[model samples]
Target: MSQATKTIQEINERIRKGTAVILTAEEMVDVVRAKGKSAAAREVDVVTTGTFSPMCSSGMLFNFGQEPPLIKASKVWLGNVPCHAGLAAVDAYLGCTEPSEDDPLNKVHPGRFLYGGGHVIEDLLRGKAVRLKCQAYGTDCYPRRELDKSVTLADLKSAELLNPRNCYQSYNVAVNTGSRVIYTYMGPLKPGMRNANYATAGQLSPLFNDPFLRTIGMGTKIWLGGGTGWVIGAGTQHNPKPQRNERGIPLTASGTLMLKGDMKGMSAKWVRGVSILGYGCSLSVGVGIPIPILDEEMAWFTGVSDADITMPVRDYGHDYPNGVNNVLAQPTFEELKSGEIAVNGQKVRTVPLTSYALSLEIAQELKAKIEKGEFLLTEAQDRIPSK
Candidate 1:
């Protein structure tokens, strides 16, 4: 059946009989290249893609439904990381890098604590107690003004991961050549292209596999935080209008995904809190998506190689993080991952902010779940951009 005609039930049936073939995103490339897209489409039933990296645009919502003397939590701290406690009396939104009260850039660059929202989440999953401290404006109805206590994951009535952005379609390679150390979300880059850091799953990423979001849109099935999740929307900076190459793949930064899932069901393995030297806190997340084979075109897209995907390597020493990002080198993920690349005729060391090995594991794990009729794929409820 064509992509327009294929149904979830039909693909699941094929998987049940062991006649349908499943391939990791890395393996799909060879299968499609050798057998051709048409042959690969008919033979491969699903392709599992994965990415494991620090996601800055991720956060969580915590609701303490059963707390005494309900107070409007004005300011909240969890595991020494301050949370956005302005939501309600008992609710808080803790982003991975929500700066502490004393984190003044002018005073102390890349300040201390080094842990924030993400660490709290991880510790909670590990069954460690989180120190919950908050101050509330005294109110007539909910009179409690302040609270200092320790709570566990079980203490929360509802904990959900509501990430506004995650899984960037692709990102720039970062380096510093301005004679000063540059601290960035990617990682710290030493001066003179001493180190280069890049983040992405390359070929084994969901949005990369489906550049146009043909089969992956709103409500797409995803492996989030070790459990099932759904694509809530297109991410914050999703640039559908980004410049693309001959293959229609973005040449610069592009799309991202909004994910939603229950926090209680998540595992510490798939979700982690990271401290990027001088860059503050971040959540090291593992995400996997299974693409259902419906047409030759779909198979072709899934097989797009790392060489086909391109990104700019930028000098991060300058200000205006996304702006004024001059291209230092244009390298494919293949070249970046080779442990070194030429920069001004000097071979520079390359470091990965995310774990490629973990990404492969996530993809393989998701594939096994689907092949065994454990994981389910959901059709998009609406287009991500609604365009």
Candidate 2:
């Protein structure tokens, strides 16, 4: 392939003129197969990728209005879920996995987690009433000590969905080879490798289409919970260097993203509360990213299919908890998506925590937005560090 490249400005101009060629990540694979990667690069302007899955590292930041007499809040709770009020007087941060203060976690039965912080966020987004309780010490300028009230999303001064880590590039396939059943964040795994669960959008994943994090970095625009958002920076535990196959796709967890957006502009459908059988509650978020076809190399990367991507299979029951770096097998996404994969000569059923159909719809929606000039690709202000 020659060193042909397309600039973001050029693509934006085409989009403004209603002539930009946009395709979903799934469609790019076929186009690259029919024509060559070089030809596809010159023909296509942008490729959209999407994922909708339970991201536990998500949370919300809220600024409740100051109360009468102006007391300094020391502790805050929403719908019985605790929130960190270590910031200013009315500023608090609610983590997704924070269980309710009165929740009978695992008391009734093993893995009987019911309510948590994720549910509270969902309730607020749906315009449902949530009870807010706060405690504050009397200050010189403040007099009130304790307060309790009901609030909704509209009542908050500002609400922002701030996720420290999200959009894992590739993840492990969780399975159980132990004697008894085990509950994990991946889901309930049956004994003797009866079931396997994986989380990722495979080829439709944003990072999978940009294995090297070439175009995705700080300040890149993205679709977050059906609203516009931006990548803040490299997420926590971001492992840029990981084991990869000959195709340059990571075989395990790799890149991650720090995403933030306005909560009022989001939809409850995409930002949902999820309760795991044994694990605590987490938020399932919809994320879509647009990749500009800058050159032939980017075209090749975006053309990757499920058949070309691979993931590591790990025993969640024992090895994961024990922190053992052992891989049972490496299976392609195509095999896992087939609803079954062979592990240690035994056939195991495969399941996904994410919705592939919904992710595809998000990609299609992003494509339409770009085609209508409602969305434009933004060059990264700073690229994420590989280290």
Instruction: Tell me, by TM-score, which candidate is best.
Output: 2
Q: How high is the lDDT of residue 104 in model 2?
A: 79
| Global local distance difference test of model 2 | 0.91
The number of the candidate with the highest lDDT is 2
| Candidate 1 segments exceeding 4 Å error | 1-5, 16-19, 99-113, 319-322
lDDT tens digits by residue: candidate 1, 306-343? 88888888778874365785777778888888898887
TM-score of every prediction relative to native: 0.93, 0.97
With a 3 Å backbone cut-off (N, CA, C), the pairs that clash in candidate 2 are none
Task: Report, for every candidate in turn, its global Cα lDDT versus the true structure.
Answer: 0.82, 0.91
